[model samples]
Each structure stands twice: as C-alpha cells, then as structure tokens.
Target: MILFGRVRMLLLRTIAYLIDSFILFILVIAGFQSFLLITGLHPFIGRHLYSISGNELHIWLFASIIIPVYMYFVTMFNTRAQATLGMRAARLQINTTGRIGIGGAMLRALIMLVPWELTHIALSYPKPFWVAHHLQSPLLYIALSLTGIYWLLPLLNLHGKSIHDFITGTIIIRWHMPPTKKP
Candidate 1:
C-alpha cells in the first residue's frame, strides 16, 4: 500500500466524490420516482418540499431516498474491494489493519454524511422561513464550516487522514498491482 501525498490524495478524493455524487444523484432520482409511482403520486405533481413544515409523507420519502445512499457507502466500503466505484476509478483504497469492519465502515459513512445532512436540513427551509427562523443561518454556517474543515483536514496531517479517517482508524492509499508477467 502506497500512501499518497496530501495534494494527490485531495485531487483523487475530489474526483472520486464527484463521480460518486453523480451516481448517487441518478440513484436518488430513480428511487424518488419509484416511491412516487408506488404511492400512486403523479410524476408531474407539484409539491412544496422547500419547507420545514413538510408532512410525514415527505419525511418518509426523504428517508427512503437517504437509506439506500447510506447503505451504498457502508456496503461498498466493507467489501473486499474496500473502495467505492469512484475510488476504484482513481486507484485508491481504504487502508486498514485488515478489512475495515462493518462498524467502522458505518461510523465513517455517518461521519461523512454530517455536512450533507446538515446542508439538506438548512436548504430545506425556504428563504422567508429561514429569515424568520434565525437558527437556520447558524445551521447553514455550521454545515458549510464543517464541510470545509472535513475536506481540508487531510492537508493538516502527514498521513493525509481526514476527520472520518481518524475517527474510524482508516487511511486512504494509492493502490497499485504488480504487472503480470507474460508467459
């Protein structure tokens, strides 16, 4: 396992994140559409989702969208590959003593979801509602701040470990296999 420098790791991780985000976006859209179909809701039906005053259906729908995403990370990270699709594309792997256990993988996934979940909450509040509720500003600020810190934490460490990595005792490394000999 070859450890990457901070800059290289950052670049690779960023690209991996972009790739993962695109894939997750597609998955989320499909899941949402499926949920609508199963519930007999029209695809074109308009609903006000940009509000904190959403109904239970909205909450359930959001959970349906989120659970699969969380599972995607947890399952992928704990697998023998120890890498997501984007990570595989970038030749990066999660370095651990052995395989990262399910608990560690799940913790890492939850930690990684912090900023995203917070941002989702903050953004769900409409402008007027956010203005009326001063707490929304602080929540948004916290989400943005945490996101920046999470992304930059690796730069502060020699081993390029981020917050989630440190919390879960994992490291990201460049993975290379020896070239196969031709008979």
Candidate 2:
C-alpha cells in the first residue's frame, strides 16, 4: 500500500539522517584515531607523542584538515551516494521530499559543504593555531556569518524552513513502514 506523500517523505528523510549520524559517529571515532596516528600525535590511549599544551602544531593541522573534511565527507557522501550509511541501513531515500534526482542531491551536498568554514574550526580552541589556521575568515566563514541569517529563515518562515531547504527543496523526514494492509 502507498502512503501519503508527506508521510513517506518525512519518514524517509528522518531515517536517512539518523543512519548518517550513527555511522558518522563511528567514523568520527575511528577516523580520528587514524588521523592521530598518521599525523604522529598520541591518542588519549597512550602516554605522549605530545599534548595540546605543547607546540600545538598538530592542533592546527588537525583543525585545518579534519573539521571540514568531516563535513565534506558527510555532505558529499550523503548527496552523491544518494544515501549515507544510516540512510542505507534504514532503507530510506533522500531528495524524495524535494522529489529531486540523485544529481540534485549531489549539487545540494556540494553547496552546503563549502570549504571556507574550516577557518572557524580553529576557533574551537580559541587558544592557538595549534591545530588550524587562524579563524581569519576564509570563504566559508562569510557564508557562515550569513548562516545566522539563513537559520532565521527556518524560524521566520511559517513552516520552519531554511534557505537551503528552499534552494535545494530538501528536508529531513521519517520513512513509512508497511503493515499487512490485508483485507
């Protein structure tokens, strides 16, 4: 049996996002471990290759690379693959709410994962360039500075929507489940 467009679309999007968050949580843990070893820093599991209180060079490098990379990875994969690990596991689809194609998903993903926000990633420490370039306003920061404005769109608009949602026509939702639908 078929469900309403709203029901199916909403559920699907939610499932997809949940799957994405769950899988990426693992990726964050596992990826960062590899990130530490490759960069020659010590994970908390060990004594020390060095700590943050030291030169903090690793801090900068990690910030410059890791944060944006994680965002890019999640968005790009979510868009291009047409499904993230969570989405796939939950058996949901994306762009269905927007009723868009895989191509549209990819385009939307790329736009949201702009490269500049990486600058503010360093600000996470507020102490040092140890893991990143200075929060010196890279290209993404400008967009992010504008994010407050965009975020307000969701609040201001009647339906709680954002500019990106308007632009990509994308949103999160829960996928429908099937019952017997028997007579």
- Residue-level lDDT of model 1, residues 146-173, one tens digit each, is 9999988888888888899999999998
The models' CA-based lDDT, in order, is: 0.78, 0.51
CA lDDT, candidate 1, residue 176: 97
Evaluated against the true structure, the overall lDDT of model 1 is 0.78
Query: Candidate 2 lDDT, tens digit per residue, 46-87?
Result: 544334442254364456455644564445445544555666
N/CA/C clash count, model 2: 16
TM-scores of the models, in the order given: 0.81, 0.46
